[model samples]
Target: MLSPRAIAHKILLHIEQESGYPDRLLQSYLDRYDNLDPRDKGLITELVFGVLRWQGRLDSIISRFSSVKLKKINPVVRIILRTAIYQILFLDKIPARAAVNEAVKLARESQPDYVVRFVNAVLRRVSDNIESLKKVDKTNLTASGIAEIYSHPKWIVDAWVKELGTEETAELCRANNKTPPTSIRVNTLLTTSENLAEELRRAGIEVQPCKYAPDALEVKKGHFNLQRLEAYEKGLFQIQDEASQLVAHILTPRPEERILDACAGFGGKTSIFAQLMENSGEIMAVDLSPWKVATLEENLERLKIGIVGTLQTDVRKLNEMNIKPFDRIFLDAPCSGLGVLRRKPDIKWKRRPGDVYRLSLLQRDLLDSLASLLRVGGVLVYATCTLLNIENSEVIESFLQNHPEFCIEPISDTIPWMKVFARGPYFCSFPHRHGTDGFFAARLKRIK
Candidate 1:
């Protein structure tokens, strides 16, 4: 029987060497490996995500004791320490001695003599200070909250500090570190939200209705193998957040009206738009990524949605389609994904704050590019899955100033959950406040 640590080491090594998402990799691992029981599967998940969440602090501990350079350590040894220390600190069930012993075994096999010795010394030292590491010192800036609780970039915290104030930013950081609730949108065309909830319940899954998104349901967390379920294969539901579902709703597509989902990579929102339009209106789903466009087509096929026309072309080069002015266009621009830190914890570590401004410029350009295709009096919903002011409201504000023909139409009480979030009639959702992924949207009408 392969120990859970061995499996975790392999997964972590893949994460470090290859460019793949931890979520997808973990899922694939669980699906492909047959020897794992539910308990072992749970252990592997805890070890992998725990190490990833506390990478910064784990490195600090290694640097404090190890004589060798941090960069020179073998990747295998590093992953061993990551798995061991992760158990020692976060997982209450894993006894400290077992973690150390297994780590030493891994180190000796994969690393040289010098590295193995150093890793042994480091893991022992970390075990001694494990209690101290777990202690919460609210006064210290590098305390557990910012270090372990948020699992976010220090620069992101600093940026949030400037924007959301110290206390509010701390709340935001805490919210991001938590395991996000699994919210899925019911395909209203196939079923109602209440019926879907009942179906999930009958299938031994607990689900609750989302307070915000009318068509969304919050599933019980730590679900195992949702893809294997007949419900998933039949496409009774889609995995999307409440806030994201709201974006398509905000677009408010009427039946028979032509729509363009510009920059619709993989078409999550586009599928929702098709459902809302009752499969009557035409939707041109365009993206720069040809691979993603192909994936989008497959997803549409899986959902049994036939109304969307998937096109693999950059909307920036608008000449690809000899298209007439559309009644509505949904611009779900790409941003730094700051608001979705809970779903993709690695994004916080990977992104620099400066990248937001660069993306803001691109978002503005994309808006202008797509706006040219909208007819006068047509509605255009500009949206982003980001919380940064630079990417959200600021980009829209800049676009409004540059384009005199477009006006920010006041969106008063379109969605009931949005009643409290009236930031000058612009819709913004935050994890801390709205219990949804961070999102921003504004309604604009082209005036003659």
Candidate 2:
């Protein structure tokens, strides 16, 4: 029966100490405390995500207020300060006094008398100077300025500024800082989108038809567990982002086609492919992790999909499997996950500057290896939830230089509705512009 703030404190500590994903950890807590008030659950979610989203700015504020350096402070005490400061600065409904009081109380539980007083004094100072702390200079376009203002790493800001200019980079950072929508794809194999939307509304969840993807819905309102819904148990839909749903459509797998979902992690898009094919195709969903393969199989069963087979093998090792040429191949290669920051803000902190360059090389290798597995005239869609050019189009360019047999195929040619997402021959969706996760995909055809 921990209070919402206490639960948030624990979750944030786990994220800082164990590198746990906020969503999964929060969900686990909520699931265990099913009888907890929905509002309290919402607060817990808000505190954890808000604290992580604005960690950079929060740390800056801490440094300004505390005599002790930010790094020298105890980790637990730092989390207490962060949660209190987040609520004080961001939440209009929460009183600054209540935030400050709760932080002192939390600190007193484990900290010494001097430390508790120190926490109280720091929060009070922040509360008195709250206006100044909340005021952001949007006109500051310098890398360090944007990093501190938008709570992004300086290197990421530098990269975005170098590639996308200051204005768009600021917009991207703003979008990443905001909360992302909860989107799910209709399991057309089990129910129609219209019917599922109706069911969700009847059950008190407000949903809207997704703007681009024909089969996806955005949850406009609802705080309860989606997995507890009868529709979820019945497998009428699968939780997925609108942008991610578009990748399978870009691949456009046909009924009875032999498809290779290379680097398939948990099979969100693979399940959509099965639905589009009316559950008639053979989809070999491959991943390097055994846990992901097991999870994919479980999700496929829950979604009532029967056509996808799970394979626990790396894409680099697939050549030794003697697999026949496939009609379609989907390489949702791993990347820096920069585009999904809105949904997973921890990524902004977890990823290093070198990660983008390192992952781009892996993406290029995945594309090169999968190219030989696709039959002549077959299409292979390479996609990532990332905004960096070095990991997206540049990876494709590097692969094409060595593998002349494959050329970029316009995504719009296969799905004309996707033309709106097109950037040159590639499909690029931005969180700021598209209201979806930042995503990049390029469809390539084996020209023989």
The number of the candidate with the highest TM-score is 2
Candidate no. 1 TM-score: 0.93
Clashing pairs in 2: none
Instruction: Using lDDT, give the best candidate's number.
Output: 2
TM-score, model 2 to reference: 0.98
TM-score on alpha carbons, each prediction: 0.93, 0.98
Give the CA lDDT, 0 to 100, for residue 64 in model 1: 74
lDDT of each: 0.81, 0.90
In candidate 2, clashing pairs total 0
lDDT of 2 at 70: 96
lDDT of 2 at 112: 98
In candidate 1, residue 139 scores what lDDT? 59
